[model samples]
Target: MDKDNDHGKNDGEQRLESGEGDTMRAEGRFIEPQEPRAEPGQSEEQAGTGDHATPERLDHPIIEEPHEKPEKRTTTELLYGVIANPVETLRYVAKHKLVAAGILIYVAVAWIGAFASIPGSLNSFEQIPEISGLPMFSPRSIIVFTIVGTPFFSLLWLVVYAGILHLIASLLKGKGEFPGLVSAVGFASFPMIISTPFSLLDYVMGIGISLYGLISLPFTIWTIVLTIIGVRENYNFSTARAVWTFFIPLIALFLLAILLVIGIIALFVGALSR
Candidate 1:
């Protein structure tokens, strides 16, 4: 009996080693093998192999490209940009505070207009030799005067106009610098250049000056519109606010002139009564 018990125990051990015991445990049915599951925050490779991960088996790191900045506009671009696309160009001008470009534009327009009038000026003065012969009235003197005075007055107007706008803008809760406003205002005068060709033609061909004046009116309005746009861009103001900021100074000056005239008339009447 002991021999039979030992033989049975040995047979059971052999069956387990030969995989027969596993099949028997399935109860004559096939069981599918389940894949391993990855833990939370753990990659499949890491979960599958733990510390046995290899560099060649892992994914490559991602690299990002650097962003490029926009290029600056050229002089020719700026010259036509204000007329063609005032909003974007003026915004760029205000941001850069391009004082030199602004001054160049102002000086160029002023000089062109001044040069165009040279012939008309000379012709008008020719009838009066006494006036034309004066050193100041001579052609050379006129050229020199325009050369010197155009830049000076251009710069002066930029400063004065910008100062007035800056003050008004500040009063209206605007946040922009004097230099920026100056640049914007100088560029705003770009539309005035439109009249140069007509002025020259009128002077050279004996065309009526009234025709030039008529053509200039629209350009003047264009300049005023550009000025408003510049003010709006620089000050971060609404259209209504920018318009008000520009016209307020002019309105104040007009009212002041009217009061001065009224006071003068009142004094004149009192003196006459006496």
Candidate 2:
């Protein structure tokens, strides 16, 4: 009975040891599952959203954008630009004011001198003695000659005025042909023509000289104003400059008048000697 009991106890101890060893071997074989890893150039969000596809490049040549051009002014627009703006007119005059003034002064002096000398010339012809060596022309003949010559002088004056105005316009950087100056002068002459009837009536009356003088004042002022406008239109100068430029010609004319008077005296002396 004792031997059987010892054998039972030994068998129980061996079973216990085997159970512990199996538990340890099972624990060693178990490994934590490896976590899933992401590859390079890929994000967890991209992968989740399924948007990791590469963008494609185009194979054909790229077209460049074309550049835009600037706008240009038209002819009528340029014409208005030349005439309408006073600032532009002044600028034109500032550049060529001296020449313009000189021409104007010459014209003024010539007109004044012509008017002043007319009566003296007529009287001189009337007083010409019908002596031996004198010309056979009578006072009536002389008067007729003078009257005939007036148109020629008038035409000459017109030509000179137009030519000078054109030259001034050219100096001021204006564009156009000579006709521009002619047209301008022609327009300016209108006031002078209108005043003529008044002048004739004044002559018929005893107060003709004073009345004509008053009328001439307005005519002169108008002429000067028109001259400035014409110059501004032709030369593209500002109004102020064109107005200032008038002095140039005025001074020249004053000087020319003095010279003309001296020349007349010298001619008179020479004639007396002859």
Candidate 3:
């Protein structure tokens, strides 16, 4: 027994000299295993699963931000925006639902302006001996015609004009829908409203049709310019494509108008000859 005790003590002394603990663990030297570090580019959730497991804890969900509303503009501002900066305004109108109000105001202004011009137009026409001889050219008839027919013709013009322009734009690979183009194109007519005051002016000033035409010409060109820009903005067309899309339909409409005038004159001549 004394020999065994000496052998065991010698073994313990050897372990201590070798910097290793004996069979029993050392007090206050217990090593705790740490969680394996998350690998590079590995998410905490992903790292926690599989080879990188850890105690599961509840995670708060991520929240999203709320959207802001668009700022409002007045009617006068809307009109001015269309006139001064049609590209931006028409694009906005193209995406908005209140476009109908703009179009409605435009229609009202145009019709009222037309009504205002009729007395002058009739006065000018009455001076023409041949035109005055017709029973249909009287002021009463003119008033009735405008009262009854203006809205229909105006809206018809709007729809047909929008449809033709949209077709041209579509052929050029433009990416706009027709309804939006209608609203945008209708606002392009807003320039005509600017000229209406001048139409009233020519009447108030008693200038003839020649001066009225002269006064309307500049505004007419401005309207066309805005229209081209509107087409470009709304349809995302290049400058050349937009101009071509605009002018092609315009040229066709002009030719059609000329043909219509010629056809009417020919019929009138035939009737007079008979």
Best-fitting candidate, scored by lDDT = 1
- What is the TM-score ranking, best to worst? 1, 3, 2
Model 3 clashing residue pairs (backbone): none
lDDT of 1 by residue, 119-188 (tens): 8778877769899889999988988888888788877877888888999999999988877888888888
- Taken over the whole model, the C-alpha lDDT of each candidate is 0.85, 0.54, 0.78
Q: Which stretches of candidate 2 lie over 4 Å from their true place?
A: 1-147, 256-274
Which stretches of candidate 1 lie above 4 Å from their native place?
1-65, 126-135, 138-140, 205-209
Better of 2 and 3 by lDDT: 3
Q: Name the top TM-score candidate.
A: 1
Listed per model in order, the count of residue pairs whose N, CA or C atoms clash below 3 Å is 0, 16, 0
Give the true-structure RMSD of model 1: 9.6
